[model samples]
Target: MKKTFFSFLTFFIFSFSAFAQNSVADEIKTLSKNKWQWMADKDVDKLDKLFDEQAMFVHMGGSWGKTREIEIIKSGFIHYKKADIHEVFSPIIIDNTVILLNRITLLAVVGTNEVSNPFMVTEVYVKVNNEWKMGSLSFSKLMGLN
Candidate 1:
């Protein structure tokens, strides 16, 4: 009786853990997709709530923290016109941090020129005050491979 009960308890715990991880991953994926749209629309209010106070953004031109990023969006310096996301891999969670990777074709209007490029974007999210907030976002231009 003891062995049977212990086995069932262990299995239940493992199953719950797996479910929790998947749930978190799904939620993060949805949030990332919405973020892309908000950026394209220049919805700074929504972004303000999503991005952490010290969040950092990395782009080919340069890297900056939350304030600069918001300024760039508001000023239309680099309009994230569209993000053609090809793939969003399963998130990797560690402690209260989640790392997500996405392969995408990005279309943007930088200054007076409109450009499109393939890139791999890495997004990091950390749980703060029971809410997930973006901590870092970096883009890596994909070489010739497309």
Candidate 2:
């Protein structure tokens, strides 16, 4: 009886753990989609709450911190007019951090130039105080873009 009960308990625990991880992964994916919309709309308030205070952002122009990123968005320096997301791969979780990849064709207005380019964006989210906040965002431009 003891052996059977222990085996059942172990199986239950493993199943529950897997379910929880899947739930968190789905939530992270939804958050990433919402973030793209927020950027396209230039909604800094929402972005501020989603981004960690020490978050870093990398772009074709240069790399910057949270404050500079927010400033750029608010000032419309690089307006994220649209993001045509092609794919969002599964989020990989390690400890309290999640790393996600998003492939997209981005339409933006830089200064006075409007351009559309293909990019693979890497987003890293870290759990803080039971809330997930973006820790890093980097964009790598790709060739053969439509």
Candidate 3:
């Protein structure tokens, strides 16, 4: 009886955790998609609201921090076009936070050049005042091979 009860309890806990992880991942996807749209539209207010005050962004090309990100947008040094996010993988959730690590490929125009590449990104979200807010986001270009 003891063995059977322990097995059931373990299964239940695992199932619940899996479900919670999936739910958080879905929310992350929705939020990220919306933020991307805001970026495309050059809506700084929306972006500011989406990101937490303590948010840290480590972008490709060795850039970091939220201020730099805003500068990039405000300066018009980077632009996203025809962007499509697919093949998301390795979503890990802890407590009320979610971390989405995925490979993203996009068509980008930097200044006057069009470039497309697959990049690895890790986006973190935390529940703040009953709302999920992005805490930190980092992305690095995947090199080697096609």
Q: Which lDDT tens digits does candidate 2 get at residues 3-88?
A: 99999999999999999999989999999999999999999999999999999999998999999999999999999999999999
Candidate-wise lDDT, in order: 0.97, 0.96, 0.77
Candidate 1 C-alpha RMSD relative to the actual structure: 0.7
Candidate number of the best TM-score: 1
RMSD of 2: 0.9
Q: After superposition, how far is residue 91 of candidate 3 from its true place, in Å?
A: 2.0
Q: How many backbone clashes can be found in candidate 2? A: 0
lDDT of 3 at 138: 81
lDDT of 3 by residue, 9-51 (tens): 9999999988877777788888887877887777878887778
Query: Candidate 1's error at 102, in angstroms?
Result: 0.1
Give the residue spans of candidate 1 off by over 4 A. Answer: none
Model 2: per-residue Cα lDDT at residue 45: 100
* Candidate 3 deviant stretches above 4 angstroms: 1-19, 144-146
Q: Score every model by TM-score.
A: 0.98, 0.96, 0.76
- On lDDT, the candidate that comes out on top is 1
Error of 2 at 127 (Å): 0.5
Assess the local accuracy of residue 74 in candidate 2 as a C-alpha lDDT between 0 and 100.
95
